[model samples]
Target: MQGPAVSGEEEPRPLLRTMLGDVLRRNRREQRRTLEDVARAAKVSMPYLSEVERGRKEASSEVLAAVCDALRVELSDVLAEVGRDLAADRVRRERVIRLDVALGRRTARPARRSGDTYCLAA
Candidate 1:
């Protein structure tokens, strides 16, 4: 059987943040590195790294890059994950736009009809 349908909504920012935090925490633990060690390597304060891992703070891209480097992981890896999340968010936005057009709440040009086929106006 098919799974339940998805709905269009703004992406869950907190959830994404939590996912990032979890990844960082798991990787650090796997490497058996103390928070202080990571902080030293990342050139950040231990308290700040702790906050980031707890999802209590939104890290700047520079800080994230440092942390990724300290973790011996590519910065692009984290960015790719963020990109996927943003793409999902974009898809949700597009779905909302389509729904609005269908409900007539937003104006849209009529689609073209040719030989029993209907195509949106370009």
Candidate 2:
């Protein structure tokens, strides 16, 4: 689950799943292919492909390879695109964090109840 956004703060970095889905959907659209077309070619259920495109499901490596093959694209190419997307997102987040710090804003987690100890270590 995502944490609540702080007032006047930029939104958090998007999930990788979300970005991956966006790339897939964009590629499909650019190729003028429908979900059913790709799903059939990939030997995957149409609904499952749809869920993956919507970022509602995390697809396995095998499935991703199949989907890329169906789309006539390379898995490495798709991954590279995702990498670029993540890099851009990181730059944006860093900019926001720097701005917040410059303005003396508290950029940590949102305020919690007194005596509540939160461990953010992963």
Candidate 3:
């Protein structure tokens, strides 16, 4: 699902399922709760809930709402946290590029196309 990233390649985006799973697991752990407890409260099967948390399965909107309710968290809040994480990831990637330039580790390279635009060679 991933390819070797070359110099000047566009930043890769994280999979939505993976990000959602990470947030769900974080929230559950923060409340010192177990998957069984939340699944029971949400009326979702324990194994299904486990799969969702592991990103092995994608949950429907109804399931997501139910899980949020069981976790005592607002669905909107969960989404907001995911948004924040994505933004942070973008910033972190940009920082790494800047640091590379600052350390003079980058050398002259041919122009590289990133998406629809081409980055001029330096």
> What TM-score goes with each of the models?
0.54, 0.70, 0.68
Q: What's the true lDDT of residue 64 in model 3?
A: 94
Which stretches of candidate 1 lie above 4 Å from their native place?
1-14, 79-122
Residue 19 CA error for candidate 3 (Å)? 0.9
Error of 2 at 81 (Å): 0.1
Report the C-alpha lDDT of model 2 over 1-122, residue by residue, as the tens digit: 22333355666778877888889998999999999999999999999999999998999999999999999999999999999999988755542223444456776856779899743321
Q: Better model by lDDT, 1 or 2?
A: 2
For candidate 3, report its TM-score.
0.68
Superpose all Cα atoms of candidate 1 onto the true structure and report the RMSD in Å to 1 decimal. 9.8
C-alpha local distance difference test of each model: 0.73, 0.83, 0.80
Candidate 1 lDDT tens digits, 41-117: 99999999998888788888899889999999886776676567666665544422344454557566567677665
Off by over 4 Å in 3: 1-11, 95-122
Better of 1 and 2 by TM-score: 2
Better model by TM-score: candidate 2 vs candidate 3: 2
What is the number of backbone collisions in each predicted candidate, taken in the order shown? 0, 0, 0
**Candidate 3 C-alpha lDDT tens digits along 1-122:** 22233455766787777778789989999999999999999999999999888888999999999999999999999999989888888655552233345455767765767766544232
Best by TM-score: 2
